[model samples]
Target: MAKIEDQRIVIDCTCEVQLQQTIIDAVYLALKLEKEICFFGNYLNTSEKEHLQQRTAFYANFVKKDIPSLPVSVLLLEGKLNKLVKELGEKYNTILYCYSGAMDNRLLEAFYRSGFPFYFSKKQVSNSNQFSKILIPVDFRNSSKDSALWGSYLGRFCNAEIKLLVANEKNTEDQDLVASNTESISRLFNQFSFPWSSVLGNSSSWGIHKEAVKNEEPFDLIIFAGSLNVTLVDKITGTFEKRLVNLSEKSVLLINPQRELYLICS
Candidate 1:
């Protein structure tokens, strides 16, 4: 999307869905975006022995159902495509999501090596750019503020309503702090002429995160930002981010310089 304008680009990434279907849906989203769109689909190349025929059949079905919509220069390639991506430049770019269920950092390194700038979930990059409504979970910490800034930016762009969520233990003191922060954010939004808004919940760290992601509402988008769980411990450290990546049915952005999980959206 380098040469493309900002509003003309959208991105969708998924680990589920038939590989070819994912590509087709991406094409649909891109076209609907009325801008350039690129969808990244990754298959475990090493697993070919188990499902090569099945995989091929899936792709065949996709072509049968949808490939006529390929809009000219949309380049689709597989294998260790890092080099091919470099040659193609940035007009269109993608890297493999193959991890062998190991969550290897090597894939992240490979993505950068391939020259793809930013990545996005299928929901975030969809044509629904305006926020008719949004749910943002925040703690009192500065980390939550990181998410706030991004959400505020989006709200300003879309003029959409907002909901700031927090989890509580019913303590009066914590409640007061939550009140102050909520007021501050609301005032900021009004100052910028953002739309209507409100806040809920308590200030626990994981509380805000889990509640926000697990919220049963069907808001247009939910954001958890700055750094979610970036502790030194092994499992739960990156695990929080991983859960959001794999488990989320919504678009989740897990950004942190330490984890090198920044999202590149043009």
Candidate 2:
């Protein structure tokens, strides 16, 4: 866990259909850990009066829920974030999400900064889902480094058989090049001490990537790294980060490279 400047945030617990379970998990986790929580939620969905009673385990539970966001409004989530933490007698804080990415993740990009502490689910799926296999997409980029490190740590925690996958792009003329490097992927996994079988999968093209996301056998979770500064060109363009949130029947944990975490709760 990493710690940043003493700033607390109030992330919106209010949301639509696809994200409801995650909000519950996030709020419950906050309450269960006894962290002084500033909740931004809907009265109908999650009321402070109802939820305060739910947080019985934590020793010092400081929380305030039910702050509404108007239609087409962008309130200073950071300010509210700090207020929540300060009210709870905490130091550093800000609001965040378990499944935010740069392109699609608004709450995070607004709040994330150098040396800021953050936390997301290491277990990347809803509590209702069960897993026997975990797929990790690994690359050598800085963003991928966070993905791989977190994936390894998380896979071990879940006790799932870890599959370390890498992308291999071979043009028609480069078949030999692709075949030659078959063993190299295994070598990379060995160096990391990640006990995983290797596969040639691309996030771009068909076949492997398609099957990876659409497997009928049930993956429960998919972990991959994407660009940190994910911006969109078109107004209607749905970012990949957002797609993960909407697409995953399970939970998606989007890990960026430079977040510090402070554990107010155990």
**lDDT leader:** 1
Question: In model 2, what is the error at residue 73, expressed in angstroms?
Answer: 28
TM values, all candidates: 0.52, 0.51
Candidate 1 achieves a global lDDT of 0.46
Error of 1 at 256 (Å): 3.5
* lDDT of candidate 1 at residue 13, scale 0 to 100: 27
Candidate 2 residue-wise lDDT at 2: 20
* All models, RMSD in angstroms: 7.4, 9.5
* Cα lDDT of model 2 by residue, 164-224, tens digit: 5554545543434344333454444455543567676654222332345554235655655
Task: Judge candidate 2 against the unseen true structure and give its global Cα lDDT, from 0 to 1.
Answer: 0.40
